[model samples]
Every structure is written in C-alpha cells, then in structure tokens.
Target: MDQFEVMSELYSDRSNWVDVRRYPSTVTCRRMLRLADFAAADPARWGSCRMAFEVPELSYRELAVARGVSHTTIMRHLAKAEVGDAGDFTARELDGECPEWLRAVSIRFEAGCTSRTYRYAVALCTFAAAQPERWRVLRLAYECPELSQEELAEVAGVSQPTVCRYLQPVRLEVDESFNDLEVIY
Candidate 1:
C-alpha cells in the first residue's frame, strides 16, 4: 500500500486506543497527511532532500547546490517536513549551564572560527579545564607575579604550552602611573 494509506490506517488504529482529544485535530492531521502525500509524490526530491533537513550540520545552501535548486525551495520543503518541536528540541539541547570549556568554544565560534577548529580548541580546553590542580596553579600564578609562566607550568604539572593557553585570556596590570589626575581636572 502507498504511504498515505499506511499512515491513515496507522492513525485510525491508534485512535481506537488513544483518547480522541489527544489526537491532533482533523485539520492539523489533514495538513500533515497532505505533506506526506506531497512528499510521496516526488520521492526523488523528498528523499534526496530529507538528509539535509535531518542533519543539523548541513546547511540549506549546501543542499541547494547539491540538489540544483534554489535555497528558498529547499527551505520551503524543510519547513513543511519539519516537526513543530524540532526547534524546541535543539533549544533544549543547548539550554543548560555550560561548562567553562564549552563557553570558551562558544566564544571562538562567535569570533567566526571554523567548526573543525572550534571542535579541536574545545577538546583542548576541556582537557585543561578537567585538571583541578591546574586551576589551583593558575590561582597561584595570579597571586605570585614574580613567578614565570614556565615556573607556573611546573607547579601546575602541565606543559608550558598548556599553561600559556590557559593564561592567554588573563590581563594583569601593575598600575605604575602615580599622577593625580583630579588636580588637573
């Protein structure tokens, strides 16, 4: 049997066990039924495009180039095929207290880093952040300005390169200027 026929039978059988109120409204159900029918009508277009919509990393522009269609057409098909909760699912995945390493990677992403580069940087950062003793050593480095970066790395039990990566974002100032600007004002 065709996909629409199978879908109808499946829904009919399900409605017998499920509450009518719980089932989607007839109008909404028909819309989805129409979408399925439309997709089944052109399996080549639908099947080839489904992966682009399903895969989070694939962009519509990339799919458009592959499918030889305008991005708008690809987007329209994706919108029709997408479940209402798809966006919510993605949001829920990212909506939580992110670890420091993830926050650092997110910063890099915002700075327009490539995905591969961001992934590698995140892995490195995660490795460094996982070392509890490194944080202690970083604290000591902050407290003791006389200590060299190499010396701090030795105390931290991490490589000098790792220590440099960890401390790169830190800004330290000695405030050597002693002029009283209030008098000039």
Candidate 2:
C-alpha cells in the first residue's frame, strides 16, 4: 500500500495510540500527542514517528504486519525517531555529554581495559545515550519484570547482549552482598 493509505489506516484507530498509564500524567500525554501530531504533519515521518512513539510495545516485525509494510521500513522509521534532532554522536561526544558514571566507564574502556565485561558495560552506556528510544525500551523492560531479556531485546530492536548489558548495573546494585563476600580456608 501507499504511505498515505498505510498512515491513514494506522491513525484511524485512536485506541491503538499511546497508553496514558505509561505516561506520567495526562499533561504528558497531551504533550506527547502534540509531538506525535507534529511528527505526523510531515508525510515522510508520519509512519515512523507513530510506530516509534505511539505503539511502542509492538516489535518492528509486528508493526510491519500491522501497517502492511516491510520490517525494514518499520526499523527505518523507529531509527529515525530515535535519532530525532540529536542525530548520532561519537563515543567521545557521548562521553562528554553523558553522566559522570557513564563517562568514567567510557574512559576506562577507551584506555584499553582488559576486562571484557567492563567493555560491555561501557558499550551499554554509550548505546543508551546514543539511542534514547532504546534506553526507553530498556527502562520499560524494568517495569515489565515478566518479560525476559530476549523479549525485551526484540521489543527494543536491539541485541540480547545489549539488553543484558543495559540491565547489568541494576543486577549488580541489588546484590551488594556479592561484593562483601570473602573466603577463608
């Protein structure tokens, strides 16, 4: 189908739009609606922004099925939405802009850290900052504890490794005793 026809069908159902409970309040919903509307005003961005922001629970494949488009098209739209005005930033630029914790990890990784796990941690932070939508998906996964990391990765359009890395810090934080354990023989 043509872009116009696809977008028309997608937006025809108001119930298929964003879930307000996922938002902080009605005000946020209104703000998001305005943004979505603005995004939809441009025919080129309509489908992508809609899929990225409105029905976030659906995977790219699912979105493609719903929209009668290819999965690659869904991915392209979501990617564009994620980039938005921020665009892509280099690791150095991300390090400069990110929080101190992220910066520290990036610095250590850049210094040729021997630990592979540490490098993954750095990659996690860098990826999150670089793709805010993916970060949002990761945060949503925390809320939906029933979903496995694999499921979350599918929803987020990221790799399983990326989902695990995104969640590693939280897992570490909850197991403080692991850090204090000592063995004596």
Candidate 3:
C-alpha cells in the first residue's frame, strides 16, 4: 500500500495519533507532515486537511467556520490537500540542452562500435528530458517488470501506443545486441 494508505490506517484509531512521528519516512508521509507543520496556511487547518476524512474528529463545518467560508470551500481545500501539490517534487532543471558526460559517452561509443546504440542512447536521453511523460512511462516499465506495456501505459496515464513508441530505443538496443552475437552452433 502507498504511504497515504498506511497513514490513514495509522490514524484510524485515536490512540495511535501520538505515534505519528514514528511513521515511516516515505515521501508521501514526509511531504504531508512537512506541509502540515510549515505551510503558510494555519497549521491546525492543514493538519486536519492532511489527515483528511480519515480522522473523523475534525468536521468540515468546523473548519469552514474557522476560515469564515462555506463548508464546501473547506471540503475543496481538504480535497486539494489529499491530491497533494505538484510542486512538492523538485522540478528538473535543463542544466544544459544535453549533458556533457552523455555527449562524451556518445562520441566514444560511436567511435568504438558500428552499432547505433550510442546514437539511440543520446536520442532517448534527450527525448526523456524533453518529454517527462514518456520518461515516466519508461521508468514504470523498468520499475514494474511484471507489468505488460499496456499496464505500464495505464499506470503512467498514457496510451499503449505511446508506451511502445517511447520504449522503441531499448527494444532496438536489445535486438541489435542479439544480432551482433555470432552463432556458435
């Protein structure tokens, strides 16, 4: 289960609330806890939102009254908290159009071999940096070997064709490697 589910289960009982500090230091838990404590919004309200509906003690109306808005506004805030913020994860800087190390590797590899593996590598790296969604699909494929391409696409919120296209470089590299080997038999 994800860290949020674990947090929900932990907070299901009032007795365990005191032990929240001992929750696993996974990304979700760390981000929620940090946001609850340090967000520009009121800490108690953020705590309620972070805990979400999992902790039944804080009512939406109560929060709405505190904020001087309708309960729907409070509900929306809670929903936003549950969804988490996109900026929570650090954005990747372009650093450079192409990293120097990758460029050097591509040059050396191309010089050493007839295969276009290095060329594909450079292309794939550039493609991934330029298109993060494709990179996410590729990453999901690597992280979940048991998952099929369609499943990976589903998990990455992309289409199966897109996943296949993004993975073409890796497939090409593997096929080329096999073709390069001599037939001993």
> How many clashing pairs does model 1 include?
0
TM-scores of the models, in the order given: 0.25, 0.24, 0.26
Give all candidates' CA lDDT scores.
Answer: 0.43, 0.43, 0.44
Model 3 has an lDDT value of: 0.44
lDDT of 2 by residue, 1-185 (tens): 22222222222212311354432333222333333333434433454544443455678788788877788877665553321223333354456864334422311111221222222222343344344554566566756989988898888788888887777643212212112222222
In order of TM-score, best first, we have: 3, 1, 2
Instruction: Give one digit per residue, the lDDT tens place, for model 3 in 94-179.
Output: 34553324322211112223222222322343344345565666566766889998898888788888888988764322223313
| lDDT (Cα, 0-100) at 135 in candidate 1 | 44
- lDDT by residue (50-110, candidate 1, tens digit) is 4452243668888777777888877765543332222222222256653323422311111
On a 0 to 1 TM-score scale, where does candidate 3 land against the true structure?
A: 0.26
In Å, residue 165's CA in model 2 sits off its true spot by 54
Which prediction has the highest lDDT against the true structure?
A: 3
Model 1 error, position 64 (Å): 7.6
